[model samples]
Each structure stands twice: as C-alpha cells, then as structure tokens.
Target: MYHIPNKYYYRLHQIRPRFKNDVENVLIYMATCLSNLSEMPSDKFAKAMNNAIKLFPGNANKKDKTINNWRTEISALFGLIETDSINQTSKPSNLAFKLSENQDLVEFFKYFLFYFQYPGGYLKPHEILDYINQGILFKPVSYLINVLQEGEKITEGRFYIDKAETTHCIFNDLRVTRQNNPRKPKNTAYLVIHNRKNNINYNWTGDVIRYAGDILDYMVIADLLVCHGNKFYLNNKNQEVIVSFIENEVIFLDYIPLYKKLNLNINDVKSLNDAWFYFVNSKLDQEIFKTDLYKYLGVDSTTYQDLVLDSINEFESKLEQGVEIKTKEIGDFGEGLVLGHEKMRIKRGKREDLLHLIQKIPTQFAVGYDIQSVEFDERKRYIEVKTTISNKKINFFSFHLTPNEWNTAESLKDRYYVYRLAISKINRELHLIQDPVGLYKSNKITMSPKDGADITFTEESSQKEKLLLWID
Candidate 1:
C-alpha cells in the first residue's frame, strides 16, 4: 500500500514556475505516486492528498476545492489500482538513482564540452545553458530557497561572478518592476544561474574543465601572445592551465592592465614595422612576420596576418569613424558651414584621443572655439574658417585662411588656419590640413612607434599617410 508524499507535492508547487522544466518534472513524479496510491484504501489516499495540500502556499484559501478534487481523482483511480495490478514498490521516485547520479552528470558535461568544441552535433554544451540562462528554476536555487525562507520578498538580488555583477530575481518583470533597484546595471540573472549550477556538489567536475577550456581559447587568440618564466607577469593571474601552456617566461597576467601597472614605456618608436617586430619577437614573445623575405624573396606575408594586427586595425577604424558629425545643423548656417564646424569638432575629439595616448592631458574637451573661428593664446593666433562643397584643389587658404590669417601668424609660434572641403567626386574624400606658414614643410614630422604607426597633420591626411608614420 503506497501513498503520495506531501514533500513531493510541495516541491511540485515550487516548480510550477513560468520557466524551465520544473513543472513537467513535478507532473511526471506525481503520476508515479498516483499509479501506486490507486491500490491503497480510498481514505488513506484522501489523507495523503490532504497532507500534500497543506504544504502548498495558498492551501488556506482553496483548501475545500483542492481536497475535493483530490478525493474525486483518487476515487476515479481506485478501480484501475484494483484491476490494473501495477506494482510501485520498487519505483518510489520517478527518476532512478543512477539517472540522477553525479557520475552520469559528469559524463553529460564531457559530451557538452565536445559539442561546444564541435557544435554541428546534437547534444551541444548550450543544452546545459539553462544552468546559465536567466530567470529559470534550479537557477540560484540555493539563493532563491534562502530568500523565500527568510520572507525577504527579495524581488531582486545580485551576485558577483568573474568580476561582474549579475542579478537574480524570481519574476521576469522584476527588472522593470524594480527599475529603481541599485543592481539594475549588472542585472544579468543568466550568469547567476551559471555560477549556482556550477557550484553544485554533484559528481560533475565540468566547471573547472569548461573554465580552463574557455581561457585557453582566449589565450590562443591573444593579440601579442607572450610566455615568460612561470614566475613572469603574463600567467600571473589565477588561471593555472593557460600559464602552463606557454614556453619561456610568462608575464603572469593579462596585457593591458599589466602594461599600465608596470608603466612600460611604449614611446619613441621609429617605424611601425620595426615596432611590431620588436613587440612580437621580444616583448610579446610571438613569432614575427618575415618582412625581408616578403620584400626581396617574394614570400607570402602570412606570418604578418594575425589576430593582433586585425584587432589593432579594427580599433583604429572605430576611432576614425567616431570623428563623423552627429548633429546636422546648429542655428541658421548653410549645410557647407555647418558640416565644416562638425568636422572640426570631430577633429578636436581625435586630438584629445592622441593626447590621452601620449599621456599628455586626459581631458578631451579642453579647447573650444565659437562658430568657425578659434584663437590660440600661446601665439595670439586668430583663425577664421570658410568652407565650400566644391572639389577644386586651390591653395588651401583660398577656402578658409584669408590674407588676414597670414598677418596673425607673424605673432604666433605655430599659427594655423585649416581649410576643410568635401570633394564630391567618386573616390575623392574630404581634404584638411594646417596651413600655418601657408606652405608645406620641407621634411615630414616623424612620430614614435608606440604612438601608433599612422600619424597625419589632420584626420583626413592621417588616413592617407598610413605607412609613413610607423615608428620602429
């Protein structure tokens, strides 16, 4: 004679959540008990149902209806229990002990890793993503259970993982409902589940395995790969396996932070090619592309093509794109004048970035000018700019630098009037340059390699002279 357990029903009510498979799992478990209880006396089954209802949260409000429904279902199943002859003595739980064992879970985790490594397969690692996805049962189970028991009405909570704050909440709309909550920015409940599930004391040891695998993947794609002695800086962080993979001395930590902390001098570069070679071959501990072989022996530049170069180029491109005009018109100026002002504004932003790169000044919005005019106090340099949509290649001053600019330059150390014009022809771009002396210099200004390879008098010219400014 078997009867349903109140604990199973209580767990079932907790599982009827809006997300995950908890509700379905509970139903399956309940079905098993239902089949067994059918053989028991009707009064005993009724008593079991009463006990189950008592554990539910709303039991007081709907006790009569709930109890009546259970009695009716038991009555209906009594005939089947008597005639169907099903034995549930050996099936106390819906899931088998072996199925729920840690060993089985550990095996599943391995399969998951294999699938992530090779995703075309059916049982991909993301199947375990529920363990990480936001707003699901079994996610932050410990945290949720604790909060519920504390009567905290937690509605919102957060946990720190890998240096990022991730939120945990029961209601999906809790984010919206609790918008004023302090943890809104780091409101990622998805990762909370990931950490919680991973910390489970199951037989599975997939947490460390997956963490190591992910770190290895990132390290392999690093821009300036380095491996100093284990005591060195690169692998200095907690990631031990990755530290073991590198040969020679390891820097012991990630690059940017280490670079900043060590205050490494990335200055006084002569040529981009030379600087890149030095960084890769020596400091970065990476293999350098054979520039000599490529130039004289006609070899492929495959060695030069790497993730580091690609990422660098992409970053530079983004900084370039940031120079575009966001606001169209300010006050009653024609399109030509308005665009010129915007161009100067964007150019000023680029100048600020350069200053930060050189560690000269941290402020991006330090200098300002009203309308199309600016005055440099150092040299008493007064500049008045005029712009045109035309493509004519006249003396640069003909566009913005009037004859008066020449007189102003006499008192200024480096007085400059910049003419910016859009060349509407195909393959033509906007032209801009500083006409300080109203003449081009005899020799180009050289830049250090660490300052970045491409240096231009103006943003437009910088793009044109991409190869000329690299300092080795």
Candidate 2:
C-alpha cells in the first residue's frame, strides 16, 4: 500500500553515490587506490578510501564519514572494484582499468545505473535489513526508466514520465505482488506495484527529492533522460539506445538469502566473498519488453492498451504517405505485424493457451531473430521481420540484413524466415522468404555486398517466395 507520508514525501533509505559529471573521477581515483592494495579488510579499505579522496582535486576537505563506504560499494557494484575474502584483498576490476583508459564519462554512469539496485552493498546488512524486505526489491534506475517510458506519447514523438507518480511508486511503500508464470517462472517473474486507496505513513528518512531526484539526475547525465522545466522525458536522440537498455533485467539478490549465507560461517572468508559477490551482482528480474506496463504501474489505466493503437496509427499514417520514420520505429512495426499474425494464427487454430509462447526479442539483445514462433506443425520458427517504405518497384525491392541475422539464418536454415514488408503510398506487399540461407545456397536470391550486406530477392524469379495476403 502507498502511504501518503506526513507531506507525501518519500526517501531512499540507502546512501547514494555522488551523482555528477565528475563522479567518474571518484571512480578513477578509487581504481588508483585499489591498484596498490592486493588485499585488505573492509575497515582498512574504507580508511584508505577516506584518505584517498582528500588527494582528489575537489574533495580535499570533504567530510570523511560515508565517502569511504560509497567508494567501496559503488565501485564494487559496477565491477570497477573487486573484493576477495580468499586472499583478504581488494583489487580494481578489469572494467576499472578499461574505464581509466577510455574515460567514457557517460558510458561509465550508464554501466553503473544499469546494475545499481536497492539493498545494495552501500549499507551494512543490518541497515539494509531494517527497511528492505521481500516486499521491497527493485532496481531504482531501471524502475525509473520503466516509469518514464510509461508516460511516452508516440504520436506526438514525445516521452515524458510523471514526476510525482514515479517518485511515490519507487520511494514510498506500495503493495508489491510477485506472480511467477508457473510454466516459465525463471523466464518471467512478474512484479506488480499496486496503488492502494488509503493513505498510510512510511517512515523512510532523507529528503524525498534528494533521494529520488538524484537518481533521475544521474540518468540525465548518463544521456537517458532530459529534464525540461519540471518534466522528465526519454532523450529523443537516445531513444534507440534507451530502448536497448530498458529491457535489461538486472538481478539483485534478496536479503534473506544473503543473511542465511552470511550466518552460516562468517569466518569462511571465501564463502563470504561468494555471498557478497552474489548480493552485489543480483537485481530484480523484470524484463521490460515481455512485461505489461500496467501490471507494474498498479492502476487500471488504459495506457497499456493505448500504446499499440497510438504507435501503429502514427506509423501507418506516416507510412501511407511515404514519410520516413526512424529505423528503429520501422523495425518495431515489422515485428508487430508478424507478432499480430502469430497471435491471430494461434487463436484461429483454437490454441489460445499457447499464445504466450510467442516472444519478441528486443533489439538490444542483438539476437538476430525478432520473433520466435512455431509453424502449424509445431516446428519452431525464428523470424527476422524487415519493413521498408520505398517507391522502388517490386522488381528492385530488397531488405538489408545484419551479419548476425544472416549468420543466424545460415545456422537455422530451415527454421528461419524473413518477413519483409515493402510499403509505399501507391501499394503495400508482404514477402515471405523461408530458409533464406537455403535460397542463397540454391542461387535463388542474390546477396549484394554492403555493410552486413542486403539479401536481394526479385519476386518474379524466386521459387521460395510467398505473397502474404494474410498480414493485413
């Protein structure tokens, strides 16, 4: 249940790192400190980090209280630093050395935000246990992105999230319900954050804005969100990148497991390291692409139902006029076409129960195939859907393929398909090329050389072609 605090304020109970442009500098500095220490206890490492910050340019007189803890855990969480109880030593991780060389400011934080989660290594186990329960497991940055993506308006080409709504859901107490799809529990763990009707008080301390807003600020610095006035929107130019990232179901180990492991034998240093490593690396497993947005958002809003209508209408209107949309948008439209057809095919076959088996792998996964389905005979099919809006004649119509997709087609020869939709203001046609790699092997479709190359198919001459009238 969501508690309307004394003033509707919500705070993160964990200590957050200094989220700024120069935050990378602190990490770089910590990497330097870790260089000399092969191994050390947590307390000594903490003290060393406290003194090391003073040597940093701007942190000369910075308070020494929590800086050390932040340095250790933040670095540890992002794989920048490592702890090993086996040798009683700490070392900078390989990523730390790479970050020092690349000096990618935005990439640094993006990597961190992708993995950062609540009940992380920042606080002592007791502190984390005080507030964190099975009820409160989340990846704040991912959750923030998920919520922001919630308020996206595709028709307007705008993506903005409700500041108050997102803050309350993440920082304030809410009824979180976990429902594992029994058939695919590990594959799909559903976490629903429900909106309760009554106002209750949650004593989470710290400035609500400071706790929540700082996270949003970090996302902005990482080129994920752009702030306008009081609103937050997904960075338009970075939308493709954002789409790729928001699907990451980073894991966070639950508190109970850690306590159980820690309680067994604190003296077993290597086991302790094993447990600590698991704790830091784990995150909430909520895949954005497969999940229904409203399930997590709580309210029975039609936002979920409206996304498809808005996006498809906008895309169709643009396509019907031969106006170009982004490459990513066109790609999504193609996949949606195939997905709709798959669902319809299953329903018509009187097998609605198996409808959930069809899955669309998001672009970020770079898995080559866009949709995973099955033939009427129950044979699996991996489809790469390509949509093109061009005035090129049917004789000249062709689609580009990534090397990954082509290799996948070559590997899954019989099970692979290319659902290419050529759309123009004058007409629309769908081409289904099964076993495109086999077609190539039989010299049916010519492969043109380009970046990742394009598979050229002239409809009049190919025996492996089918006109998909059912796509409409």
Number of the top lDDT candidate: 2
Give residue 276's error in model 1 in angstroms. 67
Angstrom error at residue 107, model 1:
78
Clashing pairs in 2: 1-175, 39-89, 251-282, 251-283, 252-282, 252-283
lDDT of 2: 0.55
TM-score of each: 0.16, 0.45
lDDT of 1 by residue, 1-472 (tens): 1111332211101111221112222222233234333335445655665564343333456657655654343222111122112331111111212112211111121111211211111112243122113211221222222222232122243222221111112222233212122223233344344445566321223332232223222232221112222111222221232222222222212222322233232221111212221222222111121111112112235523432253345346647867433222111112223233333443454542322112111113322211233322212222332322211221121222223344443334244433333321121233434443433343332221211111123453322211111111
Clashes of 1: 24
lDDT against true structure, model 1: 0.26
Model 1, runs deviating above 4 Å:
1-383, 390-401, 413-415, 423-428, 438-472
Q: Candidate 2: misplaced stretches above 4 Å?
A: 1-11, 18-22, 32-51, 58-79, 131-134, 153-157, 176-206, 253-472
Cα lDDT, model 2, residue 455: 69
